[model samples]
Target: MGSVDLIASLNARGPTSGFTDVPDNDESLPDDFQREKAKLFNPLKVGAFNLRHRIVHAALGRSRSAFATESPLAAEYFRQRTTPGSLVISQATSEIVRTSVLNIRKAAENEGRDQNHIKIIASSTTIVAATDEEAFKKRGEYLSYVD
Candidate 1:
């Protein structure tokens, strides 16, 4: 079925459909809120990655590492925040961090779970400007502060 059809089907099933809790007063929803909610809660396919929802949990530096390595507690921190059909972005730059993520994935797989539902994305940042001149200017400004 198409996206609209799927949403309609979901909505028709009411709150107990297991997708999401449909509010009883759905008719009172604003048009913009309904549109945004549809996009936010719907499954998204970007390139080869199929996301269950558009909600993205970006990783923040928690200063949980010691000696430039991820601590065991980091794994627990990640585990606590992870939910089925959710994406997690890890900004860890250490090999230990990568290993922890792999271990988590393996454990989930061994339990006969849908491993695809748990997505771990290694995060990075890039600065972009509207024009080449603006980008070049920004780069120069940034470079001036470097020793």
Candidate 2:
């Protein structure tokens, strides 16, 4: 599906969107994108350091265990996607402002990446665009993706 269709689908089934990215084939995304000629794989700076590609994942409703700890499955799920210079922003249970850090860190280390490269964030705040004009231009597109 196209990007707008995908977002609308997510909004429609937000609460029940259980790890929606699990592919039907259960196969890893091509690890060779950055090696290809596609412009999506071109390196560029996002917020700070340059990324190897333009792809960034915004995950929802993962780390589904109680607020105390993250499941190993969750770590493994993230580890598979943790290529160097890749960016993933995931949210845990909304009530869990923090959770066990070691499992995710260990998973990153096992993937041959520095654990510090991964960042875990939890919030109940609004995210604004770079400018009011930009925000107004795209109003309501990203609101209430999670119930």
Candidate 3:
């Protein structure tokens, strides 16, 4: 092997006290490109999923459900982006059959008034979202498959 390959192999074995890099012209990227480019920023795969690009969308707290109940407005927003080949990392969804109690409580708390009224309503909603065994089981199964 050449000198560069030899260096890489040494690094991989974890005994190397230093590292080296081969220089190349990076200006070959498109003139319109605005972001810095590097090999570490390249795309990677995790089993059956192959990312088309290096960009990753982080999970968001959408405050809604896939079936459109929590906030129909939030559901509509996610639905609009369901087109194929788009990379959208979504927030953790509620277990199927779950409701919007967390969101309702969050909204009331943020508004900062009517503490007693909101607490009662929030408590009731929390009870409604908490009573599902089957849904939680299904959620666990789904996570297991992904891992």
Candidate 4:
């Protein structure tokens, strides 16, 4: 589904909690929210990259790597997040990130798109579990990151 449709489906189920800040009706979609979100989906040129969207995947300090080498999953992670005409800001400290980015570029080329088009980012995520116990457990785990 599209972003708006996906959001609508979630809103239909009622009480979205932390997932959304708005109520469930069309009237509740504030103009500012729509306008701001709409801008992100619009295209823009940043230096040499003509990005398809403003949505970026910024670098995070956290690494899933268990060793000095870039995990195979690292390339897969970028591949999953890759999109045409997007930008990615990787915080990978060394040349290891080069291999991961090249892997993503190769995947894009395989898909018949220009590999140079990608650049990436994230937004807030609320933990929603099947039960209150699971939710609190997740909350505690998330808090551990903060500490």
For each candidate in turn, the TM-score is 0.37, 0.38, 0.28, 0.39
- In terms of lDDT, model 4 sits at 0.62
lDDT of 1: 0.62
Q: Write one digit per residue (lDDT tens) for candidate 3, span 1-147.
A: 443453333333322222224233311334554433533334557556665344443433243445434465554544443333335665443453134555566677789855346542211112223448866766676658641
The C-alpha lDDT values of all candidates are: 0.62, 0.58, 0.43, 0.62
Best by TM-score: 4
Q: Quote the lDDT for 5 in model 2.
A: 47
Residue by residue across 1-147, what tens digits does model 1's lDDT show? 455554444443433233334443353433345654566788888776787777665554356566545566666655544555557776656575679777988899999977777877665546589999998889898878744
Question: Cα lDDT for residue 43, model 2?
Answer: 89
lDDT of 2: 0.58
lDDT of 4 by residue, 66-104 (tens): 653456666665554455675777665435556777888
RMSD of 2: 11.5
lDDT by residue for model 2 over 28-135, one digit each (tens)? 334553346656557889777778767675663253556546677677556655556767787655444444567778888999999999897545656478998888
The predicted structure with the larger TM-score, 3 or 4, is: 4
Please list the residue runs of candidate 2 whose C-alpha ends up more than 4 Å from where it truly belongs after superposition. Answer: 1-37, 60-69, 92-147
